[model samples]
Target: MNSDEIKTGEERPTRNKWNLILGILFLAYGSYRLYQKLQIPDDDNFGMILAVGFIFFGIYDLWKYYKGV
Candidate 1:
């Protein structure tokens, strides 16, 4: 209750914004990688896997943001 004391975590306002931000970033990066994969012929599929993974996580983050969890 002291004037100089900082607010506790529970007393602070919630700002759950990183989820949306990371979601957008991840989606963009995934889409770009996917496009590159489609444009190029490669012997390795690892890049494709990574691209899909990014897309999946992106969607999950977006979902979390919307669900307010």
Candidate 2:
């Protein structure tokens, strides 16, 4: 293959690694927020929603990683 035709298949793994890392971070943060929400009484307004949103986003990232997207 010519130099110009040489393709490095490294981007996918790098991208996936980043996605996985970010996904885990988001998931952890979400879980922590959820725990905090449970610990705090009479504050069941937006914290739960935010936690769920973050968890969903993390799951999406994992899905994307699996799909190689």
Candidate 3:
């Protein structure tokens, strides 16, 4: 309880490695989808939506990991 004391294992928030990796993968997949869509003008709106969703969730995961939220 000391002001200068540091929190140990159980008291500290731990980052989820799996979440981090998933986030990275999601981002990569989203980017790839977007790129493919750009290369094909006939791409459907669904593709864009999926890409955006993936990117958004990926960013959310990374944010949670880094911000400990």
In terms of lDDT, model 1 sits at: 0.86
Candidate achieving higher lDDT, 1 or 2: 1
For model 1, how does the per-residue alpha-carbon lDDT over 2-51 read when each residue is reduced to its tens digit? Answer: 86597556554344699999999999999999999989888659999999
- After superposing candidate 2 on the true structure, give the runs of residues whose Cα lies further than 4 Å from its correct spot: 1-15
lDDT of each: 0.86, 0.82, 0.83
Clashes of 3: 0
What TM-score does model 2 achieve against the real structure? Answer: 0.71
Clashing pairs in 3: none
- Model 3: residues >4 Å from true position, as ranges? 1-12
Question: For model 2, where is the 10-residue window of minimal lDDT?
Answer: 7-16
Give lDDT: candidate 1, residue 59.
93
- Stronger candidate by TM-score (1 vs 2): 1
Rank by lDDT (best first)? 1, 3, 2
TM-score of each: 0.76, 0.71, 0.76
lDDT of 3 by residue, 7-69 (tens): 555556678887788889898899888888889978499989999899888888888777666
Candidate 2 backbone collisions, by pair = none
lDDT for position 50 in model 1: 95
